[model samples]
Target: MDTVKPKDRDFIQTVDDHLFCVVGYLHPPDGYTAYLKYVPSPDGKWGKDGRRYSRTLPFYHVSQVENTYRYLKEKYPQYLFDCPVRNITISWVPKSHVKQYYHPREKLGEIMSRGANDFLERKLLDLSTVLEDKAGIKNRIGVTGSILTETHNPSFSDIDLTVHEDNASRKLIEALRELKEEADLVKPVTPEEKEGWVKNRAERFPLSVDDLRNIAEKRWNYGYFEGTYFSVHPTRTDEEITEDYGDNTYHRKKVVEGTTTVSDNRDSIYLPAVYGVEDSDEVSEVVSFEGLYGSLFEVGDRIRFKGVLEEIRGKDPHYRVLVGGAGSPNGYIKWV
Candidate 1:
């Protein structure tokens, strides 16, 4: 069904059983290096290649990955990975391994990647199936009282992760509900309480938190995570827009009457010193000053405000800044 040709490239991969990072060249007709940017991070913690907690393959900026790849290849040489990174050989750590650090999702990823999708995500629809297919889970969500929500829409920047409790023992979920303070992601089967999702070569890869915020602030777009699909959008959905504002009250202030000026040139202009109006409150009330000047003058010529500031009004380049002598009852627009 897919029209796009399958991309093939050999790789020396550094992976955590299910979590993996492979170094390879992105094929192209135009010639460009790519960077993969994904992984779960409340604070933009992971890179694109599923290698988190460190600087690994950045899927977007592919040009700069040579050094990272070289280091990984030289590090792990025993695992006889496929020519292009397919089957991984590492399995089951020794009891004397003395595990200190906790990484819960790694185990979950391993289970899911190892033909256990039934109990993993179940195509993001059937948690019971994820349980049924996973040998360790036994076809039932083991934990008690958990919430699952499927999301498949994301902006260019968003970290995606999946949470499930099918394998967790009865004792674990019962104890989890009783606790207070604050807790992150957890599944009784894995050591880490939280973990992110990773795909060896998924299109529309997941992004970090910083990247997501950057996309939201700078790009004003939406992203998603559902089943195995990652989606990005140019404009945010209504739900996302509401999340940003954090309220249900949606209303537009109907602008009744206002003057307007449009220009893209940097030209000098003189604003006549008006009488009466010094404070911020007074400036806001002055209806005539709604949309007038390009740059308000102070003495001779010193551009005050600079930025593509917007406050509705059909996407204006800037907004009027309150400028005047402090506490003065009468003032004029001067340098702001």
Candidate 2:
């Protein structure tokens, strides 16, 4: 049987060969189940050179799946290619039905060891050089996203950089911010690029375009690298990977919404970024396994949020609404 991990992307021929982005701690009993993250489009709307394009797919709620499929069928029918819509979220394909699996770290290692061959790869190398010179993050960084799969169109693919280790990640981010401030080290996003990002975030996130632009501007980890967009993220080191969290089973409880203060966001860089909440009866904490939403909030921002409840040990333990799942959908945080 084919095995996969979080952040891996796979293709299913039964579903028009669209790429599904796997999320959550997968415990698929029969086959892999994930969210429909992207579809192949000849129009090049998703990327240059007719690369796969992404559309907004909601979280797996059984209830929302049908509506999502209808939206796709009506809005993106040309790309549908007659694939069954039910297969978008929880549908399983047997081991033999699996086609290809893309591993992020392995792909990053390949680019790092072999050197870049295309413009996107060269941009990554350029960014790496700057990071190495400025932040000492030469060996500690890896690549993720479309490039990791080798299907990336160099002209349109984004450079998804990941920094390992808590200290190094923090350092890398700090360096990126400093680079943006310096102006000479990195190029600024053009008006067109800024608008594109705003449009993209507006399509995928619940935040308004202005709020997203604000968040995007402050991060400094994303922007143009030789006219191509790139973003820097953090991951756990091998030492930080934990397999000791006892036997845990998950059940969807309810849709939770609240306005609460964040007591802490120190763990924002890690997966399932945990934040301690204060003065809220609905929840004691909020967690986002989705990386983008994780860092959106900070200490003291009263945020409006919605997500599914996850009961951790089932004995008055701290329950959290998982904000990121499936296609990185089902949850959003907005400034109040």
Error of 1 at 62 (Å): 5.0
lDDT tens per residue, model 1, 75-173: 433222222111112111121221121122333344445543332244333332322343243322211101111111222222222222312322222
**Candidate 1's C-alpha lDDT?**
0.23
- State each model's C-alpha RMSD to the native: 22.4, 6.3
Worst 10 residues of 2 by lDDT: 79-88
Estimate, for each residue in 115-154, the C-alpha lDDT of model 2 and write its tens digit.
8878788788778788867887557777766666455777
lDDT of each structure? 0.23, 0.62
Which predicted model would earn the best lDDT?
Answer: 2
Give the TM-scores of the predictions, in the order they appear: 0.19, 0.70
